[model samples]
Target: MPLQRDASPRMASMLLTTYRALGAAANPLLRVFHRRRVKSGKEDVSRREERFGRASVARPQGRLAWIHAASVGEANAVLPLVRATIERGFKVVMTTGTLTSAQVVAQIELEGLIHQFVPYDTLPNINRFLDHWQPELAITVESEIWPVMITELERRKVPLIVINGRMSEGSFRNWQRVGGLARSVFGALKMVVAQSDADAERFKRLGVASAVNAGNIKFDGKAPSFDPEAVQELQQRIGQRPVWVAASTHPGEETQVLETHRLLTRAFPTLLTIIVPRHPKRGQLIAEEIAGFGLSVAQRSKGEEITPDTDVYLADTLGELGLFYKLASIVFVGGSLVPIGGHNLLEPAQLHCAIISGGNTTNFAAVYRQFNREGGALKASNPVELAAAVERLLNSPEETEQLAVKAAELVAAGAGALNQTLEALEPFLRQETSRQRTKGEV
Candidate 1:
């Protein structure tokens, strides 16, 4: 028998070829995928064609800047950059992969910006997308190095820059196994303005020569906008009750949150635990799960009103984390407990929520560690520890207030990444402008 082939060598190239072939085969199947997503309220039926690399609207004329952000978090992180690029005289066509991100973009009021769905990364899809937009340059947000897309950008000589570049050690190690493909693909990037020195070093180790630390732009993110009137109304309704939030939680993590609630309720009888699932579509299922825990739950999406007897409130709505953050001083930012690499801690920190996180936060390792060391946030390795953390906050109002203040101070101190990233991109912006001037298109 032939020796079992080692799949490590040339694995990246092999994967890319298989990826494009699968994408080609997925073309017709996309309709079925879209239908299922639409039915589940995950896809926008009106803008489905955009996924096929078909332009929904005519591309704006002259000096177009194409920005791709994978989802809501990345899209939100790049908003300031998008606006700044527009101010610098480029028509930005921003692309996001998910419906929630599309809605997030729709909510923003940027005049020089147009939002579209990112095309599938098949050769035909990529070709069609490039032919129409013909962007002067491409900018992608944190870790969005699509191989096919990068190859196309290089072929067109459209310089690609990845701002706020991030690479986890696990990802770096995986890429290193196929160093040839990593180098060939990363070699095309004009620069990767990374979030931290560790991230920059990881990218450099993977053959990104121009990768440099620029801090994390999320520190500069605006405090999430919330309707004050709505917050006031909710406050009036809830009266004076002990409250906490388990926010941006993924599936398996909610069990831990529920257990924490169960333990906390013994001490604070009227304790209210508000769970904000990462995907709002799971509102009903989560609501049912809460009910199964012998907790009276109300879901915001279903227009269910919170009652005095309600033990849990499911804020299963969009763009409302700010509102929930204001209602509670104690918050457990989720995706940490179940090894999902954690969710953003900056949001809660910005709002002065005394933060609690779990052992895992590889997605935001640098920031999380900083927060933990400075007491800007508390870490709870298990469900029992989670309950203990919340109880600690509940028992000492002064400590809770101090921790919240410390976290907010840390967030403010972590600012300046936005300026650094803008500075890094200034050279490329000038080059694109000069090229346009040469072509008499400026």
Candidate 2:
């Protein structure tokens, strides 16, 4: 059901007034935030200037389309769209907020694509950024709603579209309390193309008249590419060991994975567990924890050898999930185990791995619904269940292969989101060539 619009004059005025006041202090507030983030190793210290609207690269002369994805997940989801935009002959400037995202984008090597750290959302920073890039069209991916940035884009008459837009029940409820503010922020968007019907309805309730369901683009995303030689080397090293990978794991979830490995190894004897933490910075600490647990471990970052005795392979590197997924027959998509919502299940699924996940997947409810319906994925609420699921797959290669086949088939069935999203956004995209030269014209 759509939400009732908050049309109270007092609420509208208060929301606008509050934002304007915050705009005045945004510069100082952002500087303090950046300092803290840098000190805590959240922000890249050398590239910190980019967060203040400073350009790290020169802007192209041709018409540019700007797309912003908040971090690695959002960045990956927007890659196909970025490729489509480049194929349209416009220079693409992609901005993201995390170091991991920056690293991942660097490996993509897409023509006409440039990645930058997004500027802080303040009036001054927004103005400086807009003036420098001067993008004719702006696309914000997922649910990164930056009020000041949207307000500036609206003021500058840039056509703004929110692609793959999502609003969870929890987020919708929070937005309801500040309905007027939500209206102001969401109102700046020319269109909000949601990933699911539920999200589209939520946008409509929040006063987004142009909300449309374009399907989830993650399903349309290209599978992660891997280096052939690297994959071959890793495969040779593993020999005939039973392998399972727990990928994109968060902080507390690592402990659960470690415990699950203990159970699996007891049954399989030579079972190899690979853990790829979401953040590579935690590599050293994770290695220490493995050693403390008396498990023989090898760190990928350190180029440690994965011998027969290596119980855990700490794939603490970036841009190699595809390699690990290909080597492992069963994959546990992490983050779901500890209420961090879930990481992308499609990655491993598309790579032909049997998928197992935890019970908490509110962020990807729609995707999970289809997976459950098709029996393409298994769910476990705790370490014991997780171990059992892995053990079952390891013991039964035929069952694992069947699950893998179903997962790949499921992904193949939902591969038209890119064309659908482009069809919906064609009007805005066409505006970019409105002033193009004719065949014989100079």
Candidate 3:
């Protein structure tokens, strides 16, 4: 809701009150929506109550820090923070919105970390969640500016800080249009630790009292992990084949990738193109697309083994991008080709794959710019360009290795953000520790 003209405080309250009432009234409809998602494999049926703020496991005995990360990317960025918080004597409960994110978090089993599906933003859900956890303070990772949660946290006097905060241009413009409402929500934040100066400035303009640029925490993250034995098995299966990977591809980009694969095969006859979709559920459709191109394809999800005749290998499984990155020396990070910002490049960079990306990486403007400037990654504006980049890299293995080294070096140099974030979070964590000790929670 846009805050009405004249910026009356009463108007903002009325709008929020109306929002809460509407959410309360839609309880039944929301249940139906949740059921539909479960049937579609979007929600975990066993843990459906978690979506309504019902806790499946009992809250632990110590002072708890609640972290809400909207999806995998944000979750990955905050992992180091989660570990550091645990090391500093705090139990952490991390929430993520998607099923895939829950799966990813499950794979990375940390001792003091608890994973829960994020409660819906309705007042009832938020209140129940906060009541059950009784968290010392709440933290959000990157772009998770839920208005109701912020408002409720403010009412309860729980400090809510945003780590690795990011504000995209389009989002900033939308918030600017509803200036007063934006102010009401953002003003409740204790602090916003932004990824870039531009993002910090944008948060400040939106009425966050404190916004600091702490750099992107993803840079300090370890590369996606894989079973080395799985990598070795795949290497044996792919022996002597020229392999190139298209990782985390989106729908529109995959069509182009299939075409590029078709073209790449003409020059390098033994080419093995691997496509890992951003959503693994799209694997079946992508496998069909590969077949429509009149190429032999094997889908990893179906336990199909890669064969000499296979032109494309659809790596549709989750938490295995590291395996594919290890197999392919040349990699193209996806979601950039069709203006969907971009996926994480640090994964390939850390895994020592020569990285290539589409031109639309506004979501990671600073890092992508530095990558291009340092010859750490190549930019392909379209499918034709992507094909050429792959062809060129395939012909020059030494150049590909050099690019990989440059990217990995750039990443190593960018590794201190996690330390800086921990330092910034020290004040809040310490205060909570002291208070919890008084209450016998420490």
lDDT values for all models = 0.88, 0.86, 0.88
Per-residue accuracy of model 3 over 1-442 as CA lDDT, tens digit each: 3333555567667767888888878877889999999876788989988988899999998778999888888888888888888887888999999998999899887888899999888988988999999888889988888888899988877789998888987888887776767889999999998888888998998889999988889998888888989999999999999999999898889899988887887898899999999889889888888898898999999999999999999999998898989888899999899888888898899999999999989778788999999999999988889999999999998999999999999999888888878888899977753445557853
C-alpha positional error of residue 356 in candidate 1 after TM-score superposition, expressed in Å: 0.7
Model 3 misplaced regions, further than 4 Å: 1-6, 433-442
User: How high is the lDDT of residue 256 in model 3?
Assistant: 92
Model 3 Cα shift for residue 190 (angstroms): 0.4
TM-score, prediction 2:
0.93
Model 1, residue pairs in steric clash: none
lDDT tens per residue, model 2, 309-348? 9999999998889999988889999999987888889989
**What is the full ranking by lDDT, best candidate first?**
3, 1, 2
> Looking at model 1, how many pairs of residues clash?
0
State the displacement of the C-alpha of residue 315, model 2, in Å, after optimal TM-score superposition. 0.6
What is the Cα-based lDDT of residue 341 in candidate 1? Answer: 84
- TM-score of each model, in listed order: 0.93, 0.93, 0.93
Looking at candidate 1, the ten consecutive residues that score lowest on lDDT are: 1-10
Angstrom error of the Cα, residue 391, model 2: value is 1.0
Instruction: Show the lowest summed lDDT stretch of 10 residues, model 3.
Output: 1-10
Flag the better candidate by lDDT, 2 or 3.
3
